[model samples]
Target chain A: MRMNLKGQKKIINIETSQYPNWKICLINELKNLNSNNVEIDCNDIDLSCTDILELISIADQYNCKIISFCSRSIKTIVSSQSLGYKSQFIIKKPSDNTLKMNEKNITFSKSHFHQGTLRSGEYLDSPGDLLILGDVNPGAKVSAEGNIIIWGRLLGIAHAGSKGNSQARISALHLRPVQLRIAKKVARGPKEKPQLGIAEQARIDSDEIIISPLDAT
Target chain B: MATDTRVILICSGKGGVGKTTLTANLGISLARQGLSTAVLDADFGLRNLDLLLGLENRIVYTAQEVLEEECRLDQALVKHKKESNLSLLPAGNPRMLDWLKPDDMKRIVDMLKEQFDYVLIDCPAGVEDGFKNAMAASQEAIVVTNPEVSAVRDADRVIGLLNTNAIKPVQLVLNRVRPRMMANQEMLSIADVTDILALPLLGLVLEDEQVIVSTNRGEPLTLNSVNSPAAKCYLNIAKRLQGEDIPLINPAEESSGFGAKFRRLMQTKIF
Candidate 1:
C-alpha cells in the first residue's frame, strides 16, 4: 500500500487488522490532519508490547510514524512491565539517550499534595498533570508540560503547558503565585489575594487568563 | 590537634541578593574577629568573588585548575594583603562547570577546613548542579535574601532544599534592606522573612552605596572604618557568626536624629 502527498499534507497507509479497535479513531485523526489519499493494507502483523522497540526501528527505517496507540493496549503494556513481566527485548540503537521514544504519554488528570512545602529556589518540572502536596513558597517554581494541579497553597511561580499548549490548565487549592505562565502567556499575582475555599483552575480562553472555581466544570 | 573543619555555604536563590558581597565582607569580618577565614567562589559560571574582594589579578590558580589537576589546592588559595588571616579560593574560567563533582567538592572543602578556621562557600543562583555540589560538603548553610518579596521567596526555597538535603542550622542574612520600606509596608520586614523561612537571622545589612564603591575598588566593606553603616553592620554580623552575643542593631533608629542632633548641639555650644 502507498500514500500520496498533497501539498503540505502527507497521506500514509494505515494497517487496521493489527489494531481493529482503534481503526476509527486513527482514521479520524488522520482525516483531521487533512490526509485524503490513504491506502489500507491489512497485514497480520502482531505489534505487542515486547515488539514496540522493533516496531520503532522498523518505522524509522521505513519512514513511518505511529502517533497514538490504543489506550487499553498501552495500559496493559505499562502494567505488565511494571508488574515485572518478561517479554521479548529489542536492543535500541545508541544515538542520543535523551531523544528515545516513550510509549506511555500519561495525562495527569488530577493531583494532590499532602504535607511537604516547596521552598524558595526549588523547581518542579512535570510532563503531565501535577498536584503538589504542600505549600509552594516564594522563589520556588513549578512547570508542567500539561495541566498543573496544586493540592496545597501555591505562592510560587507555576507554568502550565510549558511546551506551548494553550489548552493546558492550572488548578490549585490556594492560588497565590508571583507569576503564572500558561503556554506563551503569563499572569502575575500580588495585586490582590484570591479568595480561598474551593479549588480554582486558571486557563486561557481566547487570550485571557480566566480563573474560575474548580467546580465550574 | 586536628579539629573538625566547618564548611559554611552562603547561598541565595535570587541573583543580585548579595551572596558574593556577603561572602567577601563576612570573610574579612571573621578574620578581624580572630577567625582564620577562606572564601570559596562556587559560582563557576560567573566568578565574581575575586573582583568583589579586589583580588581578581591576584588569582593565579583557581578551583577549576585544582579540579583539573593543573594546580595543587594550596597553590590555588590566594591570601589577602589587607587581611593576612583571610584567603580566597577563586573560581576558574566561566565555562568550567563540569570540573567540580560532588566528591571533588567534598575533598576541596575538607582540605580548606584543615587550613582555614572558616570556609564560606559562595553558591551561585539557581538550584542547579552547581548549588547541589556546593551544599554537598557544607556543614552549615547561610541563605542571603533582601527584604523584598521575591528575595524572601527564593530564600525560602533554598532553606527548604537545605532541609531536604539534611543540612542543618541554615542561617539567614538579610542584605540591602531599606528600613523605611519595611516601615511603610512596602517591603517584607526582617521578621516576616524569618517567619517565612523559619530560620535564625544571621544579620541585616542596610542599603549603602559605599558597599558598591568598596566592591568596585576590590576591598571588603568591613575594611572601611569611615562610618559606613553597611560596613558596621557587616562587622556585627561577623561577630554574631562567631557565636558572639552581639545585640541586633536597628539601622533605621541608629541612623536617625538622636546622635546627629547631639553632635550638632555640642558643635554649636563649643563654637
Candidate 2:
C-alpha cells in the first residue's frame, strides 16, 4: 500500500492483493492517518455495496474521511457510486500485465480446458497451460503460465508464459488477436488478416514475438 | 398452450438501442396471437415503456405500491386500450430506486407469471443494480444491439454476465440495420456481428422512419403499421419467440431488390 500526502488530502492506493483480508490491511493503514480526507484506488478489487458501507464505517473509526473512490473494477465503481460516493472507473491498458506477474508464481504442471466462447470483458486465467474449445471474442482475455492453445479463433488478447516462461507459445486456428504476450514481450496483432482455413501460432523467436502457420506435416 | 410461463428479459447494455421498443411491440404482437402478455418496465428510474405503450397517463399504482402492499397487482397493471390481452406494469417512481431489490423484482415477476403466459421485462442500460434487478427475474434473455462496434461490445459483455448468472438460451437481436449501408460494406454486416456475439440471431429490425413516429405518438409500429419494415421484423420475432419457423430477412437481397433498384434509378433525376 502506498500513501501520498498532499494538503490535507491523502491518496491511499492499495496495490496489494490481500484477497479475503483486504479490509484488515486497509484498516491498519487507515490507523496511521489523523483526520485527513482520503482518496482510495481500489484497482481490480470487486467490492459490493455492503463492503463499501463497511469501508465507510471503518474509516469513520480512523477519523479519515474517504472523499472519493476509484477502481479498475466496474462492480466496485457501481457499488461506490450507489452509496453516493464520488467514484471513478479506471480502464486498464491492453498490455499492462508485467507489473501483475511479479506477485504470481508460475505453475506449469496442470493443463486447464474451457469449452465455451469467452466474450468481451471476460477473463480466463490458468495456472498452467490453457486450452479453449471455442472462439475468444474481442475484448476478452486469456492468460496462462505455460502454453496457450485455442481450438477456435482468437480475436482477443492472449498471454502465454505469464510468469516469465520465455518458451511458452500461443497457437490458434485463427491468430488475429488484438494483442499477444509471451513472457516479458508484447506485440500488437498482425495488421493484415490471416489466410482462411490456415491455423497459426505465435511464439518468441530471437527475442521477438513472431507469428507462423502451424505446419501439420 | 405452454403450461410454464416464459419470463424473458429484454436488455441492451447501451441506451437507446430499442429495448423498450422491442418489449412494447413484442408484447402487442404476442397478445394479438391470443396469448396473454405482460410487459414489466424495470427501468423505473427513466421509465418510458409506459410512454411507448401509450399507457403513461393511465398508471395509477406501480410495482412499488404492490410490493409495499398499498395496492393489488391487478390494480397496478394497466390493460392496453386496443389489445385486451396485453398489459403493462410500471415498476415504480424514480425515488423508489434506492429501496428496490432483486427480491422485490422477483416477487413482482413471480406474481405476474401466475397471470400471464409471457412476461417481458424491459431492462435499463448499464450492468448496474437496475440491470441486475431485471435479470434476476428472467429465465431467458434477448440481447438487443445495433450494427455498431460499441453496441455489439456492450452486448457481448452483457451476454457474459448473463452466462455467469446461469440465464439460458440468450438470443441476439441486431436492430436499426440499414440494408444499403450493410450491402455496401459501410456498416458492420450481419456476419461480422453474429461472428463476435456468437448467439442465435433472433431477428433483425430494418431501420425505419415509422419507428420514431410511432414512439412519439405512443403507439408501437407492430400494433398498426403492418407495412412498415420494422413492424414486420417485430412480428416475425414474436412468432419466432413462439417457436415458429421463419427464415431471417436477408439484408443483401433487401438492398439489391428490384423495388430498391427502381427507387434508386428514379432518384437519379434522369427523367
Candidate 3:
C-alpha cells in the first residue's frame, strides 16, 4: 500500500490465505520485501504465540518496522500484549488506513543514582550499578550488585558486586572507608589517615580487595 | 526548658555515651529549679533510669501498668527522695518489650506532659525499636556524646535522624570531656564537637570519678553532692537551659593553664 500522503513512504501489507502452510509462504515473502513500514493483517489468520515471536524477530532482523498488527482474533491480541508490545500491536480499521506509531526509545539502565549524604546507620542498596552524589558517613552502608561510584567522601562501609561479581569496583573521590568489600573480599581502612586530594578505587585483585589511587589504573 | 511542657528524648547513636546519666542529672537539676519533671525509662529491657535516680526500690508500678490501664499514671510515678518536683515513670517489665508499641509510649508521655513541665525520656542505645518507640513521643531531642571520635560520629548520625524526623536544632550535651586532653589537643573540644554534630551547645560535662561513684550509690550526683565538679556542671547546664545568661564553667585546671588565661582574656563563653 502506498502512503500517498507522504510522497516517499510505502507500506507493505501482508494478508494471510486460508492455507495450512501459510506461515512459511509469509516468511519467504517478507524475506525479500524491503519496506520501512509493514502491516500484518490477522483478520482471519490463526496467529500462534511462536509465530508472533518469530515474526517480531524477523522484522527486527530485516530492519523493517511493524507499524501495526491488525488483528480481530482474541488470541492474537492477548499474545501480542504478553510479548511486551501492548500499544504497538493493535487492530487497524479497514475504513481508515492511517497508522499510529510511537517511535519513542525504550531504555533500561542497570545502574541507579542517589543524591545526598547517607548518615550513620542508614543504608542504600541497588540491584545494579549505583552512583552516589554525596558522602556516606560512618556506620552508613551502600551495596550494589555492580560497581559503586561515590562523588564525595566515603567514610562508611560499601559493598560492591553483592551478587558475587568480583570484577565490580568501588570508586570514590575520598576513599577513606571504614570497610570496603567487592564480592567475597573485604578490606578495612588503614589505621593512619588516608591522604587527601587523591581519588581512590577499591576492587578485587587476585582474590584480595586492594585500595589504590585511581590514577594507578 | 522552653517553659511549655515538652517531651525530650535523651539519646545517643552509640551505647555507653551516658544517655541515662544525663537524663537523670538533668531531670534532677530541672526539678531543683522548680520545674515539675518526669523522667521516663524508655530503655525497655535494660532499664537503668530508676537505679540511677535511686528510685528503683520505690517504683511500685512500671510503664506497662500505665499502658495497660492496670494502674493509674500517678500510681506508677516514683517521686524523688529529696526533690519534691521530680518523679520517674520507670520501664516496668522486660517481658513487655516486644509488646510495647510506639503509640503506647506516646499515650503515656502525653499523660505525663499534662502534669509535668518537662518530660525527659531516657532513650535506648541503638536506633532500634525502643529508640523509635521513645522518639515517637518526643517533641525535642538532647543528643549526648563523649569527647571522642566514635561517640561524635554516632552523635552526628543521631542528629541526622533527628533532622529527618523533623526534630529541628537538637541540643548537644558533651559528656566525659577531659579538659586536660582537650587542652593538649588529644581530645575533641566543645567547638570541635559542636562543629561536627552541627548542634547547639547545651552543656559540657567533665569526666569526674565522682560520677561513677555516685552511679554505684544509686544516686543522681546533682542532688547527692551538689558540689562535685560534675554536680556543679549539671546545675550550670540547667540554668543555661532555662534561657539564663550563664557562662560556661571551666571544670579543668583553673588555677594554672591556657583555660584560665582564656577565661580571663575573653569573658565570653567558651561553648
Candidate 4:
C-alpha cells in the first residue's frame, strides 16, 4: 500500500544583524543546505539595498528558489521583488519596526496600486490584487494572485489568481488584451472584433473563465 | 553645445524596415540644408548605411579602428563627396561586437554630438544588446515601420522599449506605404498604425521603385535629381526635424499601384 507522504522544506530564520555584513553568513548557510527550496524568515532583518542584492545573489548561487518569505516590513517585500525575486513575501505585521514575508494561511490583504502606463517588456507581479490607473500596452504583463483591475485599457497580457484561485477576476475599462489568464485556464484575445463594452470583467464561471460586460444594474 | 546636441536613434525592431535607408537619406537631406550631420551605423555586424550614401569605398577607418585606438575620431569619418557637411561613421564588423559596451557606445555618440549638429545612430534590428548600445546616448528616437501588420507590431514593441528607457519625443515614420492597398482595404492606413502605436507621426514615405534604384547606385534618392518621389518625402522629414513647418506629404495617390495608373490611362483614352 502506498502512503501519502509530505516532503520537508528548509526554513532560514534570519535576523542578520547578529553578524557584520550578514549576507556572508546567509550565503554560507544557504550553501550548506542541501535543499533547493528555501523559506526565508526575515524577522527583524534590515533589508537594505545591499542586503536584498546579496540575498538574491546567494539564492541564485545555490540554485535555490524562494518558496516563501516571513517578513513584517512591507518595504522588504517590495525590495525582494525589486531585486528580481518573484516569490511572494508575506507580511507578518510589523516586527521590530521592520516588515517581513509567508504562506497558505495568510494572503496579507493582497492588493497593489500602480499609476502610469505599463510599456511593452515591462512586467508587474503582485501577491494579491493589482490596480493600474493607466493602459497596459502590448508586450507588457501584469500578474497577481487575486483580481486585477485596470482603470484604462488592457492591451497586454494579464494573469489573475496566478497562485491558482479559480474565482480570480480581471476587469478593465477597455479590455483588448493580447492574452488573459485566470487560474489554470488560458485564453487568447479573440481574432475577430472585440466585444464593445464600457467595462468588462473576466471571472471563472463553472470550470471556465468567462469574459462578459459588467452589469450596469 | 548648440541647444544641447540632438542624438537621435533611427531604430526598427524588425529588419528590412528601411532604417538604414532613412538614416542615409535623412542625414544627406539635413546636410543639404547646411546643417552638419553625421550618420553613425550602430548595427555592428550588419551595416549598409555607407552603401546607401555612396560612401562605402571611401571608408578608410571604422568605429572598430577608432575604438582600438588605431585612428583618431576624425580619421574614421567618411565625408560625403557631394555633401561635405555630411559624414558617415561606419560600424565595426560583427566580430568586434563582443567588445562594444553600452558605455563605449554612449561615449562615442557623445563625442560625435560635440562636433555635429545632428548625430543619427542607425540601430540594428531587434531589441538586443546592439539596440541598447545604439540607444545609450540618444535623446530622441524615430521608429520606422512598414504599413504591414507584422512590421507595425514590431515597431510597437520598439516604441515601448523607448518609452521605458526614457527616450523622449519618440516620433514614428511610416515607410513603404502602398496607398493602393489601403484603398482596397487590404493594408493598414497611417491612421490605423498611429492609433495602435499612439505616437506622433513625423513623416511618411511612399513605396517607390526609385528607392531601389538610388540604393543600388550608391546615391541617396534625396540627393538625386530625378524627381524621385521618395526624395521629396525625405526632404520634408528633414525640414520637419529642423523645426521647419513643412506640411506632411499626403502619400495617398502616390501609393496607387499599377492598376490605378492603367485605369487612369484607360479613362483618358491614352492607353
Candidate 5:
C-alpha cells in the first residue's frame, strides 16, 4: 500500500509471514523511507523483512526520502540491516556488524555533540560507552548500557549499566550530580562541597552506588 | 524601557519533590507582597498545581486551549479569588501534551512576561520532552529537592541540564528537610546537599505536615502562618528572587532551636 502527501509520496510495502502485525512493518518501512513531509497510514497490513527490503529498494529507485519509522520490534530492526535505514539509527546491535565480536559485547565510544545546552527533561540513552564532552548540566540525563565517561563536569543525572550490568561504571573529572544510578540502585554524591582537584568514579558496590576518588596508584 | 519579567522555573528531575506545591506557594507569596504573579504548570500529563492551589474548580480554560486557538490566552487564565494579583495558567487536559509545541510555549511565556511581574513555571519531573519545553523559555531556574539522596541526585541532573542549556542564575530550593532526621544522621544535611550540587542555595524548607494539609485544602501554605515552616521558607525564596537581602533561615535552628540544632549539626561534621 502507498500514500502521497503534499508532493511527498510514501510507498509502503508489507509481508506478513514472520510477524502478525502488518501495521508495524508498514510503520517501520515508512520510517526507513526518511521523509518528514510524507504521512503514512498502515493500519491494515502486516509486514515482512523481504517487504521492507523491497520498499527500501523502491525508495532508492524512486529517490524518495524516508523520514521516520516507529516500531515495537526495535531489537529486530536494529539487528537486521534489511530495513535499509540510515541517520544514526540508535540500535542494540546491527547484525551486519555482528561478524566483528560475538564473544564480548563491543562498546562504541564516540562523542555525540548536542548543539545546545541540555535543558530539563532531556535524556540521552546509548547502548555502548558514552563520552559526553559537554557538561552534564542539571535536569538533563544520560544513560548507557555500558560505561559512561564524561570529560566535563558531571552535574545532571547519569546511569551506567542501565541493562543490569553491575560491572559498568560512571566516571567524570568533576562528579557532582543530583543522582547517580547503576543497574537498579541509586546513590547521591559527596554530601559536602566536593573536594575538587581530583577525578572521581562511581560504581555499584554491593547494590549501592559508591563515589570515590580515582586512584593514580 | 520595560522591566524584564522574572522567569523562575521550579524544577526537579525526581518526582514527588513538592515542586508544584512550591510553585503555588511562591506565586501566592509574591502576590501577597503586591507583585503580580502567575504560576504556569508545565507538567503536561499530570497537572496538580490547580488542585494544589484549590483553583481547579475555577479553571474555565487552560494553556492547552490557548495553544489550540480555541480560546484567547486571557480566557484560559484563572484568577485567584483571594489574591487579586495572583493568577494561574493551568495545564490543559490529558491530551495537552500533544498540542504543546515548543514555539507555542515560547509565545505563551512571552505573553505572560508582558503582563506579570513574575512567571513561575512548575516544571515536570524527568529530563524529557515536557522538561525541555519548560526550560526552553525560562531565564532562571530553581531546582527543588528534598533532604534525601534520590531527590538530590535528580536535582543534580537538572542543574547540569540548566548549565548546559545556559539557563542562568540557577538556584536550589532544599525542600522537605527533617531536622530531626538530619540531626540523627538518618538524612542528608543542607551542607551535604549543597556540596554535592555545587549550586547556590536559595531556601531550605522544613518538613511540615501542615504543608500537606494546606495542599489538600487548596490553600497556599503561606496562608497557614501558624503551623507552616515551609511557608516562611517560600516567602524568603520570593524575597531573595526579588533581590531582597533577607537572611537565610537555618532549618536546624527552626526545628531544634538555634543553640541545640547548631550543636547537633556541628556534631554531624557537615562542613
Candidate 6:
C-alpha cells in the first residue's frame, strides 16, 4: 500500500497472482493498511457488482472505506461504475509479444471472444480486439481498443479503437449497423440494404468512417 | 399426481405482447387434454390471468395468503368453472410487491408443483424485480413476442437474460402474427424474428378478432371457440408443449389457401 500526498488515504493493489483467492488476499491487505480511507487498484481482475458490494462490506468490517476503484478489466470498471463508485479504466498496453510482432508489420493483441447474441441494452467492451460469433441486435453496443470482427450480423452500434487508435477496423458478415465509430470518426449506417451473402468492413479513411465490402487483406 | 411437474414461465419483456393470454390459453388447452394444469399470476401489480380464465369473482385467497399461511394452497387456487382440470392462482394485492422476494415465489411454485402436472407462471412485463421473481422458479420458459421490431427487440433482451440465468430449452412463441402483413413485407417475418432471438419456434398465434372478444368476455378463445384461427393456434401450441410432433402452420400458405378463406368466412358467420 502506498500513501498519496493529499489526505492520509492509501492505495492498495489487489493482484490476481499474489494469492489463490483474490478476495482473501484483499481482506488480508486491508487489515494491514494504516489508513481508514483506501483506494483499491484491482489489476487485471474482473469483479461483478455483487462481488464489489461484498468487498465493500468486508472493508467496512475493518473500518475502512473504499474511496475509489481502479481496474484494468473493463468488466470490473463497468461494474464498479454501475454501483456508483469512482472507478478508473486503465488501458491495457500491448504485450511484449505484440510489440515484437510489430517488427514484422503484424500487430496483434489478445482478442475477447463472445459466443451469443448481444441483445438490446447489452453493452460489451474489450480492452483489445473483440470477436463475436452471433448477431449484435439493435440498441446493443460493442466497443474495442483494437479491431472488432463479427461472424454474424451487426445491427447495433460498434466502436473500434475506443482508446483512439484509428488503425482499428470493424467487420461483420452483414455490416448493417445503426452506427459505426472508428477512433474519433463516426458515421451513420447505410440506409439501403447491403447485398446478401457479402461480408462488409468499416474503417477510418481520410478522417471519415467508411463502410465497404471486406477486401482480401 | 404431481409427478415431474413442469414449471414454465411465460414471459415477454414488452407489455401487451400476450404473455398472460398464452398462459391462460395454454392452461385451458392442457386441461382439455386431461392433464391437470395450474397457472399462477406472477404479475401482482396488474394481475389478470383470473379474468382471462373467467375466475376473477371466484378468487378469495391468493398466493400471498398461501405464503403467509393464512390459507391452504387449494384455498388460494381458483379452479376454472368450465375446465375443471385447469386452475388459476391469483397473486396478492400490489402491496405484496414490496415484500415478495424470489424465494417467496419459489416457495409458492413448489407448493403448486405438489398437486399439478404443469405449473405455468404468467410473468409480468419488463425485466425488473417482478419478472426476476417470476423467472426464479421456472425450469424452462416460453418467450412470447409479436411481429414488431420493438417487441422482438425486448424479447431478445429477455432471452439474453434467461440464457445468463441458465434457463434451458427456452422456446419462442410468435404471437399476433399478421400473415397478410408478413406476406406484404410490411411486418417482421418469422425468419426475421427467429434470426434475431435465435430460439426454437414452439408455436405461432395468428392475429384474430376473436381473441379480443374472448378476452373481453373473461373467457379464453380455446374454451368455447376452438374453431377460431387464434384458438386453433393456441391449442397447437399446447399440444407442442406436451411433446407432440405437430408441424408448424405455414402462414404464407395459410393466408393464400381457398380453404382458409372459406373457414374464415364461416368463423365470422357461424361463431
Native-to-model Cα distance after best TM-score fit, residue B125 in candidate 1, in Å: 2.3
What fraction of the real A-B contacts shows up in model 3?
0.62
TM-score (all chains, Cα) for each model: 0.59, 0.75, 0.65, 0.73, 0.58, 0.77
Highest-scoring model, lDDT: 2
Which 10-residue window in model 6 chain A sums to the lowest lDDT?
A101-110
Q: What is the C-alpha local distance difference test score of candidate 1?
A: 0.74
On the 0 to 100 scale, the lDDT of residue B74 in model 6 is: 90
**Which 10 residues in a row give candidate 1 chain A its minimum summed lDDT?**
A36-45
What are the lDDT scores of the predictions, listed in order? 0.74, 0.91, 0.79, 0.81, 0.75, 0.90
Off by over 4 Å in 4: A1-110, A195-197, B1-3, B251-271
For model 4 chain B, give the 10-residue run with minimal summed lDDT. B262-271
| Clashing residue pairs for model 2 | none
Q: At residue A94, give the lDDT of candidate 2.
A: 46
TM-score of chain A of each: 0.50, 0.50, 0.54, 0.49, 0.48, 0.51
What is the Cα root-mean-square deviation between model 1 and the actual structure?
14.9
Docking class of 5: incorrect
Q: Is candidate 3 or 6 superior in lDDT?
A: 6
lDDT of 2 by residue, A96-212 (tens): 473555334333336799999999999999989999999999999999999999999999999999999999999999999999999999999999999998999999999999999
lDDT of 6 by residue, A1-217 (tens): 3435347778888875657877888888987878888888887788999999999999999999998999889999999999999999998777775466565553344568999889888999998899999999998999999999999999999999999999999999999999999998889999999999999999888888888889764
List native contact recovery per candidate, as a fraction of 1.
0.94, 0.94, 0.62, 0.25, 0.06, 0.75
Q: DockQ, per-model, please?
A: 0.45, 0.62, 0.38, 0.22, 0.06, 0.52
- Measured with C-alpha atoms, the lDDT of residue B97 in candidate 2 is 76
Model 6 lDDT vs. the true structure?
0.90
Q: What is the lDDT of residue B79 in candidate 3?
A: 91
TM-score of B chain for each model? 0.91, 0.95, 0.90, 0.92, 0.91, 0.97
**Over 4 Å off in model 6, which ranges?**
A1-110, B269-271
**TM-score-sorted candidate list, best first:** 6, 2, 4, 3, 1, 5
